[model samples]
Target: MTIPNLENNRVKLSLLDLSNYTHLESIAQQKDLIYYSPSDISTPEALKAYVQTAVDGYYHKNTIPFIVFDKISKNYAGSTRYGLISWKDKVLHIGWTWIGYEFQGIGLNTNMKFLMLQYAFETLEFEKVEFRIDDRNQKSRKAVEKLGATLEGVLRSDKLMKDGYRRNTCCYGILKAEWPEVKEKLLAVIG
Candidate 1:
């Protein structure tokens, strides 16, 4: 798929597009942001490795990653990706998301997710869009819940995080049928 851009609201999805991993480097400098996810990647090398792996994975399929930025703040905020694409099946997953410490609880993530889900359902016409979180991540789980995605059950031992521990995945999604209402709720909350 072509890299997404703001015009399509699907701007270039890979860091490679934004100056060959420059975005990753920006994220590496944000020590305060990387800690938000349950994983503790405390060093520069660790952070670089984390982003490199994600870059490699996105290259493997219909997946794509994008760096989030704030024009007003004029700084990189975090990273988010869309992958596990099943175009024929009409499904997609959005995760690997993180925001800077200062940006958290400021409604930026909600607004970002709002734009993404809206693009997927309204712009791209996707039938279903999902958010998967580590089951133990209450903050993330609650965040998705607050956005109005319905809980779709959990997948046990789904995959190992970079820390080499197994993760129980919690799935949440908004169907095309539910998008109108969910979008309304998301806009209300984010706005």
Candidate 2:
């Protein structure tokens, strides 16, 4: 149940090679992806701290994050990851994902997610993949739904964000048994 740090496939829209801090810092500075309404990353220092946290997490193998690159735009669009892996349960969570505003609704996420799901199911042999989105994030909720994940439920007071209050989280997931059909549907929608 060892998940590789990097999973490459033809469908990958971008690869976030975070082994280099400068690259990660540069990608984080791109405002489009980092400029969401509720986003608290206003300065380079703040972004660096955030990237450092992610880097630390990845280096320790607790989290794996990647940068999203749009082949057409030839620019880094955002970041996504495999977090909170439960090897014994054959489960993994893919959340804390963000795509720049320009890349939204452009199939970039679909392609990236397709690659991730393939790697998780085929390579890591995970039984289930989950996404936990902020309850207030309709865009994310819709995107996950479009990816063919089922909304499981909501965890009230799930966590505290930079804004200093507990945020409710909406859970969505697709099991191994559902991936075939789900993947097909996703391809059709994105293609």
Candidate 2, backbone clash total? 2
Alpha-carbon lDDT of model 2: 0.71
Residue 31, candidate 1: how far off, in angstroms?
A: 5.0
User: In candidate 1, which residue pairs get closer than 3 Å at backbone N, Cα or C atoms, i.e. clash?
Assistant: 4-10, 4-11, 4-12, 5-10, 5-11, 6-9
Candidate 2, residue 51: CA error in Å?
Answer: 2.4
Q: For model 2, which pairs clash?
A: 14-69, 16-67
Cα TM-score of candidate 2: 0.82
Each prediction's TM-score against the native?
A: 0.80, 0.82
TM-score of 1: 0.80
Residues 13-63 of candidate 1 have per-residue lDDT tens digits of 234333444545555566555433545445656666666666676667566
lDDT score for residue 67 of model 2 = 66
- Number of the top TM-score candidate: 2
Q: All predictions: root-mean-square deviation over Cα?
A: 3.5, 3.3
